[model samples]
Target: MTSLPVIDIDPFGTEVLTDPYPLERALLDAGPLSYLSAHGIYAVARYDAVYAALRNWQGFQSGAGVGLSNFRTEKPWRQLSIVVEADPPHHDAPRRVLANLLGPRAQRRLRAEWMAKAHKMVGKVLDGTPGSTVEFDAVTAIAEKFPPRAVGDALGLPEEGRENLLPFSDFLLNAFGPRNELVAAGAPHAKFLTTWVMEHCRRDALTEDGLGGQIWAAADRGEITHEQAPGVVRSLFAAGFNTTVHALAAVMHALVTHPEQWARLRAEPSLARIAFDEAVRWASPVQTFFRTAVGDVPVGDHVVPDGAKVLMFLGAANRDPRRWADPEKFDLSRDPSGHVGFGFGLHQCVGQNLARLEAECLITALAERVETLELAAPGERRLNNTLRAWHSIPVRARLA
Candidate 1:
């Protein structure tokens, strides 16, 4: 049997968190499973290995918590996500409620309304630009603005305190990493955000037709325990907003940097969905998730010991050369179906349809109105433990 390759690198250090590709390459080159001695964790970067771990939930469990701190041993900063942080039996009910509530059929009711909202938002953005060639921060003016208004409305969150959503989401994603400065800085706001989220998730606070109300409705029907309902709502609150926002920013960054691809998208607007998926594959928004080994699980030539934390590098797996041709290049033509950008298997993003729909609406609206999209300046990165997002993506758009 081959011995595990032990690497001395801080996976949560600011350097790797800021720009992780070099470390990702090193992990992949080392082998399917490498031990990160800096953190005492096992890491997997290859697509095949990561995918296998994600799909084998019984072997690689989520109940331990999807971050560096295992729930079995240490207490989480907050209550664990019922869906993203649990395995079968316990995960099934909430997952079913959300999957059905946010599923394709449920999204159809939202599609027309969201598309109209996207067009209106795009028009407003273009109007505010001040010239035929208008320069603006795409992250703030476009990506950040759209998802909250659209999905927030859908979730029936109150209009007041909506500004707090993104910051809270950032804090939540950061907590998934180790107790670093990023997490430390956001810690103060965690209580306020938690209170706000919990208060709003109450059955009275949500509109009857909105997604949050629907989860409560499920609890009413006893599909899920009443105690489980708020956590389910919190799950959506935590996972839904920031991911779509960052994903939008990623797609915009990908398109503007690659003009030919932008032109292709404009020419064939139907490719918006595929473009979003490719962008996600190219610039993974949610980077890494830790899965605990249920028992001695054989990975490649070695076995991960029971109760050990195994980190799956979603971003690295998305670009694995073995799984994708020209993996580094962002191409809409590539079928990014098997990509782990939204993760794989049971814990795959339940809100993916809603996310894809949001992306399709926003990208299609932009493709229709903008003739050319180009970066006005180098974009700044938003450093977080889990997300690869932009602080600002300055761009100049030529109106069609």
Candidate 2:
């Protein structure tokens, strides 16, 4: 083929991570597929192209690895996630097992229990004693705390080493991109955190009553190989934790920043799911996921060479005007159903139902109590190659 547009942006640089929307907007303005000269990888940011690429898995596959370092060549930093890093045949069984285990029906048991826990948790945080104000960092207070407790209890993971989940997940997502400072900083601790995660995934480490045990039960049913069971369990925190926690933080930030949306949610608590999805679309918390080109694939206008790494900017596409009107605005009234906040197609987030349920429960409790939520100070971003995290978001929630 001929040539495509070239953008000189370092897709993972500190500048873009601080405020990514402008560079992302330029990506949309640049044709469908543009070469990031800084990284030497082709980039896709348009909504239609990204939406199509996610579906045409055979053409742009994840099996080679969903990171910059292709598994076909380099060894992965950790054991490959059968669910996140595999293609059809190998992916088939693990996907089915996770689908069966993590889906809404399987997680239905946690609905009422988690909801009750959330009410108690929020009540404690913003104890409404007539006319007093309660303030806390939503990141540490709710987002970071909820997932591990809910998921850990569900998986029967011991309470002792649960702190490792966040850093472990950060390292894993960073490993997907270039070995930059972010990944390097976590290198020393990777061994310990990774060891903790692997240990927890074991059938022996899990309680027979939780979902981790359910994975072993799937192993027994011939759904997956016995050896593959723990890795599948690993997928729970690997794919599920960082994404859900960060998204929760992002959505809470959105609601606090957009008082109208919070008011609407307070008036009609059922819009919790809608607000969550909208925040995801607006924030694009889980930023980039890579797919290697299988062959000479036609992406947008250019034919990419065989084995070229195609970096899909999910954050950019979520805000593409072609897909969303006034995409920058976090509007609860907006329908964010097709948003790539949770990827797309068969590889779509398997734990989405769980994430949605978490948001619903937490938001329901907050809506019932908090009269007005306002930012106590400017929020800080926890920059990572793949995740958009909040280091701290100070907010004061007043109860009427």
Q: Which lDDT tens digits does candidate 2 get at residues 1-400? A: 5468898988889888788887898889988989989988889999999999999889999988898887876767567778888999899998998888877676678899899888888888886585678899999999998898887788788888888998999999998889999999999999998888888888889999788998999999998999999889998878878889999999999999999888888999899999999989999889999999988999866977788899999999999999899988999888999999899987999888888998899999899888899999999989999988899999998886
Question: Looking at model 2, which ten-residue stretch has the lowest summed lDDT?
Answer: 72-81
Per-residue lDDT, model 2, residue 147, is 90
| Cα lDDT over the full model 2 | 0.88
Collision pairs in model 2: none
> For every model in order, what is the number of clashing pairs?
0, 0
lDDT of 1 by residue, 49-159 (tens): 999998899999999999888888886756788889988899999999998999888788999999999999888888744347877898999899988899899998889
Poorest lDDT segment (10 consecutive residues) of candidate 1: 126-135
User: Which pairs of residues collide in model 1?
Assistant: none
Model 1 bad stretches (over 4 Å):
128-131
lDDT on C-alpha atoms for all candidate structures? 0.91, 0.88
Measured against the true structure, the TM-scores of the candidates, in listed sequence, are 0.98, 0.98
